[model samples]
Target chain A: MKLHFSTTHEDHRIALLAALAISIYIIESAFPSPLPGIKPGLANVITLFTFLCYGWKIALQVSLLRVIISSLLLGTFLSPTFLLSLSGSLLSLGILMLVHSLFYPHYLRQYQPSAIGYAILASVSHISGQFIVAWYFFIPHPELFKLLPILMTFAVILGIVSGIITQHLINKLCSTHNK
Target chain B: MFTIGNILFKTTDFLILLSVSSLIIWLYSIFWSTDTLYGQAETLQVQYYNQVAIDYPLDTDRIIKVEGSLGSSIIEIKQGKARFIHSSCRNQFCVFHGWLNIVGDSTACLPNRVSIRLKGTLNPYDAIAGSQ
Candidate 1:
């Protein structure tokens, strides 16, 4: 498939989304986390918005580009942090796509998952992927698995928050475009 | 009305949220319930090369020297708490682990083949969950 941003409009939209996501990622990193691996993951808001507005292909592109470009800007490219981010993004995207397909079959494109469902699934999958990677490759300790409950709790809370924000943004955009 | 992908936030979405929240609560309770016995360790078991070396009551305040694969380790037990004060291992992970006052807490010095585990009936998990 032709994955390139085919038109100037498409390019502009992708660039805007990527910029928003990257900035959110960088800013979130500046905040102090109560725990080492706990963060709100606010950048996912833009990705979810793009997926709801556009489609999975563009959403995937935007999400991957955001992770790569943000990692490079933060000087974490090729580091363990970068690997974790990449793995989380990939896993979340895969789960989102699967859920999307399941909720909206090929013939029924109108019925898609609600924002809350998408966000919860994405967040849970993303954290699970990172936790597995950190436990097996980085720490290799049993104590790390003990942190799962706390992390999952945070994921659920942050997912709902970001999902609500994305839903609002999508609604505003749609209303404006309809006028 | 806020919506995304033509799907509105409806009663169905509320139901999903409620179910997910309950599931998370259940998991949290199972994993981190404070009702489980903690800080009630009755016995301290030391192992060398996967074999039991010594078992002692945790009520006393004393230091024990254990011989392992590499060299000797000094384990200190005080005020119902046990810890490795000194070990010949290079990493010193056991020493840095601070204390093992809980029923299921444990520490190991892989290089010296020495491990200490607290044993009690109310320990929640049989073994720490992790990839083999």
Candidate 2:
């Protein structure tokens, strides 16, 4: 049985992906933490999977669509703050695409790169994009470089947690498929 | 093909090492010296505010001290008038919005809902934070 039904199998795959992406965005926005601006990006895991199961093109499409859709739904479409999120997602997707290409080839069985790389890269890119947005928003003074280390620390911890969760899920899926 | 398990194990180990190293470095940077903490505090303040956004220019003495509220409001400072300081807000982020110790400059606090116009040093944190 095909676990992920494509358009040919379950034409609703796109919608399902979209719905899942929406949930991810909500979780990202609503879930507050002591460390400001940190997110698990649980939805990106789906993007990674799409990139692996399908191709980079589809993965990119899913991410872009999800971001735009979520931004619109959340009423942040035209706001500058929303732009930060868009940039982060795009940069993160770019990195994930690179990772997916390297690890999940056509001939691969039920394995992929360690979730650590994804977690780290995704987090780094996300924070990087955020910093860029911050740079533009703040402008002048040119004194914000001081916060990079602290932000990076937050990214590292969140990335580890997200990566571990993604890893567990992937393992579970593989095991389930085997059974 | 690299198995996912192997990749995960290796990445986990690497992350563990990296985290440990960073923790040690941060600790070293923290207790061992005041430079790192002060440096970080400066950075945090700047980044949190989107970098230094001076609301006034130098050489202006019109000072409008914001004593209450945490919101940015415009105020005109003259050559010899200075008033406005302290705020009810918890963070006092507005108090840090800026200072006008000169002749015609102005500073506004978004958090404290206050603005000060004066002619003096734009570097408010200079005296307190020192040498950033």
Candidate 3:
């Protein structure tokens, strides 16, 4: 006898968003990177959009699925690259959750972080987490920290670009929903 | 919301932007600026097995071979950078480390028992360990 599987709307949404992130990740990986940690991180546009629009539970689900599925698809599952991606995703989601909690109250609405703010925080935490893990496990050398500034420079720039794209997507999403 | 290029950037966004920029600049000043550790590296010290280390000035360009347990490792210094040109070790990690130009930077060929370190007037280990 075959066991029946059931799914919900939330599951479907998570799957769809994760698919988008994974496709972007695969395409991004196709390009040769000049440095190890520097990338456009265009896939982050989806994550930031999900966190800014959807609640934390859904955002976390989508982001985790994205990292895990994408690594498996790329054959990097359980490798150092996979570990770095997992750590980066976890830290980014953690920071976004914290930011949303702190800034989402009605009184705090004026200080609410826009997509750009969330994207920058996510990008910084993601790279910081990956860098720390890399230094600890692989290199464990002081000289490795020297690359942090350069990696962070890329993170900030890419974060802003992803943020703008995310804001635009959210705007388009809102208009269609209202209609 | 602050509008630039039709994007809704808010106060907190600018605040985060400023903070991250300053942090990156601060790290750059500490690590990548011209006057930091790389500027002070004046000597390359090579050690072979249990032998006393020999200091080579960075001003001159030359090649040196140090006898190791496995075999001799070839080293070259040119234009203020030092690197292992060849090593008998299979991994070639020391050679792969590329260049050593920072005052505290060091690399060792573990299998061959040869090591190289960049040094300056001030001993960083002495400063860190408080006695050396």
TM for every model, in the order presented, reads: 0.63, 0.54, 0.69
Better of 2 and 3 by TM-score: 3
lDDT of 1: 0.81
Q: Each model's interface RMSD (Å)?
A: 3.3, 5.8, 1.1
- The sequence of per-residue lDDT tens digits that candidate 2 reaches over residues A1-179 is 76974455323665677678778877778878766666566777776555544556766777788888888888889587678877887888787776556555666423444665567677777778878887877543345655666776677777767777666666655443210
Name the best candidate (by TM-score): 3
Q: What does DockQ give for each predicted structure?
A: 0.19, 0.09, 0.54
lDDT of 1 by residue, B80-112 (tens): 789999999898989998998878788889999
Model 3: per-residue lDDT, tens digit, A52-121?
A: 7776787788888888898889999999999999899889989888877887678887788788888999
- Please tell me which model should have the higher lDDT, number 2 or number 3: 3
The lDDT leader among the candidates is 3
The sequence of per-residue lDDT tens digits that candidate 1 reaches over residues A10-99 is: 878899899999999999998999888889998998888787678888899999999999999999998999999998998988988886
After superposing candidate 2 on the true structure, give the runs of residues whose Cα lies further than 4 Å from its correct spot: A1-7, A100-112, A137-141, A174-179, B1-7, B11-132
All candidates in order of DockQ, best leading: 3, 1, 2
Question: What are the per-residue Cα lDDT tens digits for candidate 3 across B8-50?
Answer: 8888898999999999999998987644544577899999878
- Pick by DockQ: which candidate is best? 3
Rank ordering of all candidates by lDDT, starting from the highest: 3, 1, 2
Q: What is the TM-score of chain B alone in each candidate?
A: 0.67, 0.25, 0.69
